[model samples]
Every structure is written in C-alpha cells, then in structure tokens.
Target: MWRDSFRLQIFCLLMAVLAIVVLVHNFFQLEHMDDDTISGSNWITENNVQHSLSQTTKTTRKPYCSYKQQTLSKREQAEQESLLAAILWPKPPDGKIAFVESTDPAHSDFVIVKPVRFFKVGDELEVLVRMKDFQGKPKQYGGDYLQARIHSPLLKAGATGRIVDCHNGLYKVFFTLLWPGEVKVSVSLVHPSEAIQVLLRLREERPDRVYFKSSFKSGKYSETTECNVCLPGDLPVCNFTDLYTGEPWFCYKPRKLSCASRISHAKGGYQKGLLTQEESLFFQSDVNIKRPILSSGPDSVIVKSKAFT
Candidate 1:
C-alpha cells in the first residue's frame, strides 16, 4: 500500500510539470502571432504615411508669367511719342533734357525734345525710359545705348547699357555725383527707332537710412526710398529697415533681397509648400500608442504570461 501511494504521488508531480511546460509554450506562440499581426499593421501605416507625404510634395501645374507680343497702331504711336516727350523733358522747373528716338531702324528721327530745369552736384539721379516699336508697341532691343554727358567742368563722361531681355516697357539709368557743385547731365537714348524716353529726374538724396514696407498678395512687392552702397569691385549691398517689425536686414546681393524678406516672414511656423491635412496629422501621430514590442528574451514569455494572466 505504501509503494502504490508513492508511485501515484510521483506520477501526479510529473503530470503537473508537463502541463506547465505545455502552457508556457502555448502562451509564447500566441504572443508571437499577435506580434506578427501588429508588425504588419504598423508597416502598412508607416508606408501609407510616407506615400501621402511624397504625394503632397510633388508640384502640379500652375500659372506662371510668360512672354507675349503686343501690337500698336500708327495713330497710337504719335500719341505715345508726344507722351514720352512730355515725361522725359517735363518742363523748365524740373531741370532735365530728354531726347526720344523713333523705333524705326530705317528712320532715325528725333520724335520729341524737351528742356529740364533742376541741377545739382554730387546728387544721385535716375533716368527712366522705355523703347517701343513703330506701331507704338513696347519693344525690346538686344543692346541699347543709355549715355549721360555732363556739361560742367566737374563732369566725367559716363554711360551704361542694360540688356532688355524682357518686354517690360521700363528701363532705368542710375548715376551719382558727376560733380559736387551746380552741374548739368545730358541724357541720351539710342536704340533702333523703337526706343523712347520715359522720365528724367534730379532727385534729392535721403538720409543714410531708409525703411522698406512689403506686402504679399499673390507674391511680394516692396516700397522703400533706400539706396544701395556698393564698393568698387565688390558685390552690391543694401541695408533696409523692416516696416512691419522695424527690424534691420542687410542684403549682400540683389537676388537675396526677396529671399531675406521671405525668411523673415516665415519665422513663426509659417510654411510655404503644400501639405494635406491627413499628411500633417500622420506626421504628428504618436508611434508608441500602438504598443510596439521592441525586444523579447527567453524568460520574457514566461514572466509576461504569469504576470498578465
């Protein structure tokens, strides 16, 4: 009787050990199956997020400026010639002389000539002009002559050419200090007959500083009464005070002027490009919410099953 009882006790102990082993193995296999399912779901979600972001980053067709030819009639040409003369040579009080050239390469006719009054030394001056074809349409010439000759003793002959690659119908001639005292600078325009004088001015210099106010509609446009200071053989530079924030900015080159303004405005979490609502949400989603299993050890299955169950 005692031997039988001992055998029964040993068999029961062995059965208990086998049952525990099988239960632990089954728990681990179930955990592995859940992990695989979760991993596949996470991969799908991540791939979707990346795909959405990429799609939003792509650029679609949009409206941009393009060049087009414009035509003008002969009667309109005469009226435009008259207007150009009046603007270029305004009157005695303005103190400037403007000469207009006909656009007809076949004919070199002086379309209009007028007298200007203002004159000063060491002053910054700007000559605004434009060129148009015989039909009075604004025309662009490959290379044009814009010359300024000072009659005073302090004057050194100076002229510059700006390439008219675009048909904007506007050109400017900028110069400074031909001579310090009372002086006169005669401005001339030469291009195939299509060129015309638009404006001439002896503008007073402002104080050393100026402020620029910018506004953004579809794009940006700025207004300021500032002059750029550039060293000889060095790149042009300008200092401008922001009208909106009253902050100061330095522009090392002309191309950077727009970029500087954009950067300044984009400081407070302002983004310029396209991003969809869903894409943005996905970017900000919390990855840990899915309860990712980062690592598993030999004892983790047994420990987790016992603790959670």
Candidate 2:
C-alpha cells in the first residue's frame, strides 16, 4: 500500500509540470499577436494623417474668386458720353453725301467747292463728299449738277458750282473736318432748291462725316412744253426755246434724243450755222422744233416741265 501511494503522487507532479509549460507558451503567443495589432493600427493612423495633410496643402495653393464692385475711369466715362452724343444727334433729312464714280467724260468727278465744314481760324477742315444714285449704285453720274460746296467766312463768298455727276437718282453727300471747332454747314443741291441743313461741333480727334441726299424731283423737261409728248405708235418730236441761250434749237429727227445727241449737247455748244444752204434747211424739215401733233386716242402724251421762277 505505501509503494502504490508514492507512485500516484509522482504521476500527479508530472501532470502539473506539463500544464505549466503549455500555459507559458500560450501566454507568449498572445503577447506577440497584441504587438502586431498595435503596429498595424499605428501604420493606418499615420497613412490617414498624411492623406489629410496633402488635401489641406492642395486647397491652400488653389485660386479663390469672389464678387467685387466694378467702376469706370474718367476718360472711359467721357468717351462713352461722346459716343452717346453722336448716336443721339439728329441725322440730316436729305440723307448722306457720297463721291460719284462715272465713266462719262463730260461729267466731273469732284466739284471744286469750299470745305463742307469751316474750322476755327487758322484751322484747315477736310471734307469728303460721296454721291450715290437712287438705286444705291456707286459712281454712276458724270455730269455738272452733282457738286460739293463748302461755306465759311474766311473763304470766298458765294457758292462755287461744278459738275460732279450725271447719274439720275438720290445723291448722298458726306462731310468731314480735320480740326476742332463749331461749324454751320448749308448743304445745297443744284437746280433743285430742296436741300439739307446740319449743325455740328467738330473736334480734332473726334472727326465726323455728315450725310445728305439731293432732290431728285426737280429738273427741266426735254420734250415739248405746250403739248403732251406722246409715243403712241412712233416716237414724237417737240420744240421750244432754249432756257439758257434764247436761240431756236431743235431736238433731232428720231424725235427722242439719241445717245449721240446727248453726248453732243454735253460737249459745250454745237456748231450753230452748219446748215446755211437753202437746200440743207429744206431737207431738214423734220429737225425743226415745232409744236407736236396731238392724238385723240386714249394713249395721250403728258408734258413734264420744271416750275418757272
């Protein structure tokens, strides 16, 4: 019995020793795992802090915009006022003036007239005049009626007349000045009394070009005055006293003035006594300026004449 009890005590002591060894090993493993978790948590926190700092640095470097009050300078305000004045000013009733472009040799391209606007004393004014027809076609007239006139006190008195264009239609006249000053301009049309009036204040840097159109509704009639000029079946001829020369003149045989006749008349005076022979005058019966024969038909001739002064 004593020997059995001693064996049992020895077995119990060996089991206790094994249990203590296992418990020590487990405790060491648990400690190592805890250290790894702490390291991982520290790494994650460092990465989050670095990312937040990068975002903050980028935001600080970016540009920022905000609404602000705006204002104009004095010079800018003055310029705006000048432009507004020009826009609000009344335009000439007769339209604008333009240069005539024509191929006819008898017509003068530019009329010699005073500057359209007169600058202050000792100041030279430059004016540009352009003539355009009713159809808006450029450079069409080549005649004496279309011309430019400049009115000023220091310049020559009375209006200067010159042939500018022969084109039939509304004419546009443009005027400009080089210097600065207030000037009164009287725009006149030849033969036609209706003209345009314009008043302007010219400045050195603020040059202006004013516009006016000529009266197309006036001019002397070329046909007969007493009777209505009609072309029922054939062209009719008419005769009357020449307004300028008080001489007996005849529009040629075709009754209607030919292009050749117009060209001839525009070239100053034609040879008057060319047909002195008796036979020549007799043969030229159709060339005589006489009263036209009237037709009772519905197609009656209408006479167009200018109003006498």
Candidate 3:
C-alpha cells in the first residue's frame, strides 16, 4: 500500500510540472504575437489574457496602447522618408513657390463658419478657413497669410476681420458687428506658404497690388488715393484728408484707423490717408443697411462671398 501511494505522489508531481510548462509556453507565445495581435484585436492584457501570468511578473502589458504607439511611430517614419525623397527629387514646376502650400480656393476641401451668423449689434463672427491641397485634404503645415473682411452694401456697413493662423492649414477669422444688416464675409489668401512677410510687403508697397482709389468718370474726372493713415499709440486720427481732392474726411464712424500698426503692414511706413476708406464708402452709400429678419435666424443675415483668391 505504501509503495502504491508513493507512485501516485510521483505521478501527481509530474502532472503539476507539465501544467506549469504549458502556462509558460502560452505566456511567451502571447509576448511574441503582441505586436500583431494588439493592433487588430481589442485584447485587454491585464484582465483577460494576462490574468493567469500576472502573479508571475506583477506587471501587465498595455497591448492596445503599445500598438497605437507603434502605428504613430510608423507614420512619423513614413513622413520623414517622404521628406527625404522630396529633397532628392528633381526640380519642380517653375511657377510653383518652393515649400509653399497653396491656399487657392479651388483647392479648398472644406470651410467651417462658426455659429454661421451674428444675431445682434456687437455680436462676434467667427470663421474657420481650412486650406486643402489638390487631393482635397488639409495641408500638413501652414505659412499662409490670410485676411477676412465683412461687407454689407445694403447696410453701407463693413468691418475688417482678424485672421488667426493655427499652423495646421487652418485659419480663424474674428469680426464684431457694428451695424445689424445683411453682411457678406470675404476671406482671401494674402500670401502663399513661403516668404509671407516679404510677399505681403511687396503687395502693399506697389499700388497696383492692393491700392484703392475714388474716382469719377465725368468731365475733368478727379481721382483720390486712400490709405489707412494712423499714428502709433492711441492717437486720434484728426488731420486726415483725401490725397487727391484735399477734402477733409472724418474717421469711419466705427473707427477703421488702427492706433497700433497692423500685423501685415505693407513694405514701408503705414500708407498715409483714409485707411478705412472702403468701410466708410459702404457707410456713405445710399443703401439702407438694416437688421435681418428675426424668425428666419441670424444666419440669413450673413452670406459667404464667392472665392476671391
């Protein structure tokens, strides 16, 4: 009886050893397939797969998270490889600006306007301008100088909007309503993706690029040049006049003369004259700017202008 009992005890020990070997084998197999399995499978290692082995290592693997890291790393590697390839590639087309991502409206994938419209006086208008490539996707980087403006011819009201660069092919425009009327918001790319400041300076310095004039086609037609003439600090713009006619022009009622220098100033010192001429002209026009209908929603009051770039 004693000999039989001893033999049984030896058999039981061998079985226990076999079970441990199987568990160890399974653990190593899981580790080997971790990279591939984690990505496609939502396998939680700690609670499920690793539950049996947790007591051995006292640590659990974040398989899915590790898989995500691997994916992002691979993407970054691919981007780097593409960049290297571009550098080694032959010269591109002549007209293309080097390293510049085009902001042409034709390439725009989509644009989002926040809140769609302003409801009342002093309401803020926000626009999100997304620049896309010919492939209809947001550009990877940003170096474009964008500008936005609000105009309402019927209300004779207008305001210059602010542009915020998000550095990811997205721009934000902010505007405040001075008069409640049907308004049209216009966004344009002032400069391409490269040498933005230099290009802007060139555009501003040359009258042919961005200058506006007031002229009449009657007998002995007269013409006048207008600029946003303002001094630094909060100085009042009192001594302003029409460049050609020498007639005194008051500041736009809403005030277009910026006390501070604009971020995108032209080549030289601020062009001297009525900087707010466009907005003021809209105000002076006979068009009666009025608030939009209430029931149709404020969005009915604001309209997006056609592509201007």
Candidate 4:
C-alpha cells in the first residue's frame, strides 16, 4: 500500500513541472509579440515626430548654424568663389558638340619639335600636338585632359612630362631627358571636353549616381536597405554614426528588423542610364576614352652618354 502511494506522488510531481514549463514558454512568446507590436506603433510615432521637426526647420536654422564649430564669413565665401574658374579646366564657349565634333585621338597626332640625332641626359625634348575631330577637322577650342609620359622599358625607368594647353586645341608636351637609353614618349587623351561637361553635371545634379546598401538581421530573419552619405525622402533611418570620428552613416530603416540588427554594409552599384542620348556619344570605350595619340614623327628617341650621345 505504501509503494502505490509513492508512485502516485511521483506522477503528480512530474505533471506539475510540465505545466510550469508550458506556462513559461507561452510567457516568452507573449513578450516577443509585445516587441513586434511596439516596434510597428513606435515607427509611426517617430515618423510623425520627424515631420514636425522638418516643418520647424526655418525657425531652428539659426541655432543650428551656431551649433557648428566653424562658420564661413561672407568675405571668405567670396574669396573661394572667385577661384571657381580655373585656367586648368577651361570650358570652350561653343556648346552642344555632337560625337563627331568631339576630339578624336586617332586622327590627332604629336611630333617632336626638332628631332635630334642623339639626346644626352639633362637635355629636354619638346613635342607638339594638334587635336582633330572625328570628321578629321581641326578643333578650335581646348579643354582636353591629356596625359604625357616618357619611359625606357629596358632601363625600367619612367618620367611624367609637363603639358601646356594652347587654348586653340594645340598642346605642347616637354620631357626632361633623364636616362641614357631608348626613351619612348606617349600622350593619351584622358577625357574629351564633351565627357567633362557630362561628368560635371552629374557631380552637382546627380551626386547619388553610385548607391550603397546595408544588411539588417534579427535571429533567423534578415533584410537589406539602401544607404548613403545622405539618403532621399523622409524615411526613418538607423543612425549608426561613429562616436569618435563623428562620421554620420545612416541606413534606411528596415521594414521588420530593428536598427540593432544591422550586420554589413557596402557600395551596391552605380546608377544606370545617367547620360542622355547625345551625352552617351562622348564616352565610347573603343573610340575616344584613354586612346593614345598617334605620333607624327619618331615615338622613341635615342639617349646616351657623350660617347653614344
């Protein structure tokens, strides 16, 4: 009779433990449920808060500007603005040049000013370049970025040449003779003036041509959202700005995941179709971009000591 009573008590103890575990499990689920509901409702509340702050921007602008450590004065602003038109990046007055009107490196050529039989170290070599268009016509304006270099592959030596733009689509490249060997000179057109205009327009108007994205994860769930130095729209974001550097990095808020769940971030890709039909003609890989100009005379000059010179 005592054994039967002992067995019954053991069974009752087991049932009580199982009931407690089930109750605790349900409580945990309820807590997580509360988090989900709070997350949704708080997001809506934050959106309203953001809207109010934007509306009061004009009134708060003065204090905002004062909060900065340094502010530029009117004279300082004028001084910097005065330097906007640099001689280095001259823009020709004639606008709306078709692709055929752009500079063609293939038709363009450079020739040694005066070919010498032998060049000695410390001697200078001067080359003249004439720019031409696709239709084989001379250009009347200058704004092309040309890169010039002199190198001796056998000696494993190289030196950059100085270029002077003559504003009438004429360029002069000068190289100082440095090594005693066969020195080859090369001049390449880095960008046409037409492409420069398109690039400048993108820099100011479409600054967000290249975009970035970040991944947010929570337990088994994950999400991806666009990110950048500055994002468009009034969407909520996770302010993961660095405390020490004070560099601000913001990612658009994920729909379901929390801000704490962000794991990795990187540049996604460039925006497509940035250029118009006419602008697209300026950037052809096979045609003008980084094409080397043909040499009208000898591309390489023989340099030596007094004996071989």
Candidate that scores best on lDDT = 4
Cα miss at 251, model 3 (Å)?
Answer: 38
Over all chains combined, what TM-score does candidate 3 have? Answer: 0.33
Can you write out model 3's per-residue Cα lDDT over 191-255, one digit (the tens) per residue?
Answer: 44533433344444433333322111122221222323222233233223444433322221112
TM-score of 1: 0.21
- What would the per-residue lDDT of candidate 4 be over residues 93-173, giving only the tens digit for each residue? 776788898999999999988898888988999999999999999998888989999998877899999999898989999
The lDDT per prediction is 0.32, 0.29, 0.44, 0.76
List residue ranges in candidate 4 displaced over 4 A. Answer: 1-88, 217-221, 239-249, 256-262, 306-309
- The C-alpha local distance difference test score for the whole of candidate 2 amounts to 0.29
Which sections of candidate 1 miss by over 4 Å?
1-120, 140-145, 153-167, 189-309
Best by TM-score: 4
Ranking under lDDT, best-scoring first?
Answer: 4, 3, 1, 2
TM-score of each: 0.21, 0.18, 0.33, 0.69
Name the regions of candidate 2 deviating beyond 4 angstroms: 1-118, 151-181, 191-309
Ten contiguous residues with the weakest lDDT in model 4: 51-60
lDDT, candidate 2, 20-42, per-residue tens: 99999999976764543323212
Provide the clash count, candidate 2. 24
Which stretches of candidate 3 lie above 4 Å from their native place? Answer: 1-101, 109-112, 116-118, 195-309
